[model samples]
Target: MTNLLQTERLIIRSWIPERDAEQAFVIYNDPEVTHFLGKSSRVTSIESQRQRLIEGIERMHQRNNGTGSWAIVEKESTTIVGTIILKQLPDKDGLPTQDYEVGWHLRRASWGKGYATEAGQVMLNYGFSVLNLPVIYAVVKPENHASIRVTQRLGMKPIGRTNKYYGIELLLFQLDAPVKIEESSS
Candidate 1:
């Protein structure tokens, strides 16, 4: 399968839920992991996880613009470490907005290993270089310190809290396209 993006130690690609569900279950089924995310992000059963993955696959195809969910696999062991996403923000009414957002979720064991930051950086490149997006946003719970640190590592600037998206208040971070410096011929 083609990779959406890759870092030095990870491959970001399509989610094969059937193959990834058990590991994914270990992540999404954990209350500790799902605390910052809303209730709908939880997977109560293998069947529900399958349903979510099916929906995610469909969403990946529908976007056709490198915007959607993807599985993050570690290169060393070929294990699914987590999920990374570049999706349009939805308004409070669930209507898709032009604003694109980047996010990630890593398993507990994978935390503190920098997978989220690495995957996020590559997706930001894909969004800026391939998709030509001028800016990308990330919505995080104010209490999600680890994710906030990741956003900071990605050079995303905090734009303050917003209630315009997700029907819940969130701290908004924005990353603008890097300015290209043209070299002058001597």
Candidate 2:
């Protein structure tokens, strides 16, 4: 249940509502950040967001498999810049698709910094290593070129588009578990 992970310059840790709600509100409220996220508008109140954050944490903990949204913190500043998520998405039939997804959302100020890709790589590593998944997936809005690039940097290839996610069509990208090669000796 402990899902703390580290990268060269970032610390990916579990979401604590009390500690993260304010920063999360700022990230979630930014229209530019939420534009591709499918949120209708900015979150208006910290109280409401706190409720949502509580629920989000509960859902992740419910999974009980170290899969959930975690705060993306700057190692030097100790600031919560954004979140990186690894979780399962339901299929069209409302059953588990058995597909784990990797995604990131950062504050506008934090954009253009390679944090998303940095955090994403570790999450993918954890998914494949700790979780032992066969393949991981990402669904991005077509117009969000920045995120598309992150997925590309993660070496995720576009499989296709589908409306199965959140009832809307999205560009699907996937990365398979790395195949190991063995040395042959004469």
Candidate 3:
């Protein structure tokens, strides 16, 4: 229910089951959308999708560390185009890992626009500014060029490939917060 950030054209808001479950189902189940999203196939049940939303909500509330997914909505249409996630990768035991991640999944209809780049900047800013995280990571499937482009536009550095984190091979990109330079009058 919390509105996390707002861009010129998109509103990145929290994942609320009562408000976002149905659309979340649509986004998660679309094959084209899920094509690079790992071994998971199109989710078949709205209930299951609702559960995922519930879990995301719980996770967002669990830590004041600014880790979770938010719904990306277009301001004019007020449509849920996709989601942007900023969270730490979980360890094998499902606990938070050292590497924090920033990623996005947009509707097929929403592809090719700058929405991902715009929304991603907001999330990255939140990670660095609000969360005070020194670095944030983005792990993408090797074949997912669109997302790669998005991360690049956000000024993230492509570190290397890694299978250790997400249980699958991914091209890991990282971005450190811009250092603040205080002004001093001579």
Candidate 4:
């Protein structure tokens, strides 16, 4: 699998063993970032976090054939900002499904800068074009206006509402492949 994917101002790439633990701690520790996520159980050690990252990578490989949560980095500084995940979840029918779900979280400092939207678009394109997914879904807390706005910007429309993994209410949005336009030669 390719190590890096470039966007206008960001680089979406696989996590390196060296950086996995540090990044995991950032996500697990930040309250503001983890608010909608329910808890703030900071990863105590880099090693454990690294192990989790390794396992996550392995699961992604096993399931999706090589695509999963990508570390989001700034292009200029190459600093790890956050993560973008294309997770696979089961459908209501209790059967294995192939829906692509998009999610993101960044440091407080990175909020309000349009980075989420920018990175999200790249992932959405990859989902539809590279992954050839028919639809991409996003689940956000009803009160997560920031994420709701990001999903809207990506052309995702609200599909329904449901209880999330942690039993919290969530709003579901989806974006399907854009309709192709044909030109007439007169």
Candidate 5:
């Protein structure tokens, strides 16, 4: 597993079994953070959540060749603050899909500090450059102004609304190929 990926203030990396349970409790147990995610209450069982995190890490390794929902760590303290995921959606005709999905969550303590936007931009760069994906997508609830703003800040434009995997109404935003500069011949 990759040890670290960095933004200006954060480090995105693989889940450490020791640190993840507490981090999971912090994020999953918060009602405000999980509001649009379809869960009604905070998950109380740390062991179960820890197991789930391990499973997710394993599954991500199997799926993406060692890239997936990385534990977003604070650079100064090296704490697991949240997670950032970049994954491909299933394809239509038995072929792999090029349009990837990006998502993130942070502990309440980390909110309102632009960490999400910073980490998201780093993930987007990895997606387009390392993964060579042509486009990336994000789905957010219409009322999730913070998430929508993050998407907008990344220069992702709204494509449409769709029923997400959790059966919630979500606004789809997409970022295509990066803009190219044209050279003028005098």
Candidate 6:
């Protein structure tokens, strides 16, 4: 959708595979980073990542909604540090539901720098304010304390573990939209 979102310290924008693939590969190919994301999400080579991102970018455009993945960039350094996503949640049992998820994935170097939380906060604003979604959910693996803490920082409340999404048990968190979206002059 070419929507550019900004936080005080980060920029969230669309993926340019040619420019973003290398750094994205470093994150997706790292065992430590991908451990909580599941085995199928791993990238084997830069070429594969480039191809995947190219396809992903196309799918994102086709969806044409505000929901999809966005590249997270560090403001000062102008480096891509991660991705923040707000998208439809895949149903585990072929049931229809209005479940959308908000998530973040930061490179190891960007971890603990509050970038994830910053990007997440902005995306929440976009989802609730721009998209007018009633609520947004976050699904985190139980042991992914870092991500869980980010959700807490974003003001999401735990709704207990469930296998209703992704066909696996995950700790679910939810946040209902505020009465009104906060208006900003920027």
Total clashing residue pairs per candidate?
0, 0, 0, 0, 0, 0
What value of lDDT does candidate 1 attain over all alpha carbons? 0.91
TM-score of each: 0.94, 0.91, 0.93, 0.84, 0.85, 0.92
Pairing residues by index, what is the TM-score of model 1?
Answer: 0.94
Candidate 5 ranges beyond 4 A from true positions: 40-42, 90-98, 164-167, 179-186
- Which residue pairs come into collision in candidate 2? none
Candidate 4 structure quality by residue, lDDT tens digits, 1-186: 345568888988887766567866676667778787665334556787787778877877787554588888888887878888777644655344566688998877788889989999988888777877788889888899999999998889998787643345578899997665789898
Please give, for residues 73-120, the per-residue lDDT of candidate 6 as tens digits.
Answer: 888998889989998888887453589899998889889888888998
Tens digit per residue, CA lDDT, model 5, 73-123: 898898778889888654434343555789988888999989999999999
Instruction: Give the TM-score comparing model 2 with the true structure, all chains together.
Output: 0.91
Please give, for residues 1-37, the per-residue lDDT of candidate 2 as tens digits.
Answer: 2448999999998778877789989898888888888
After superposing candidate 6 on the true structure, give the runs of residues whose Cα lies further than 4 Å from its correct spot.
Answer: 1-3, 93-97, 181-186
Residue 40 of model 4, lDDT score = 33
Q: RMSD in Å for candidate 5, one decimal? A: 3.7
For 52-123, candidate 1 gives per-residue lDDT tens digits of 888888877887777888889999999888999898999999989999999999988899999999999999
- What digit string (tens of lDDT, one per residue) describes model 3 on residues 1-186? 668899999999887787777888888889888888855546778988888888778877788666888899999999999999888897556677888999899988898889999999999999988988999999888898999999899999999998768566789998999997889887
For model 4, the stretches where C-alpha displacement exceeds 4 angstroms are 40-42, 91-96, 164-168, 181-186
Using TM-score as the measure, the top candidate is 1
Which of the numbered candidates is closest to the native, going by highest lDDT?
A: 1
Better of 5 and 6 by TM-score: 6
Q: Report how far off residue 112 is in candidate 4 (Å).
A: 1.2
**lDDT score for residue 116 of model 6:** 86
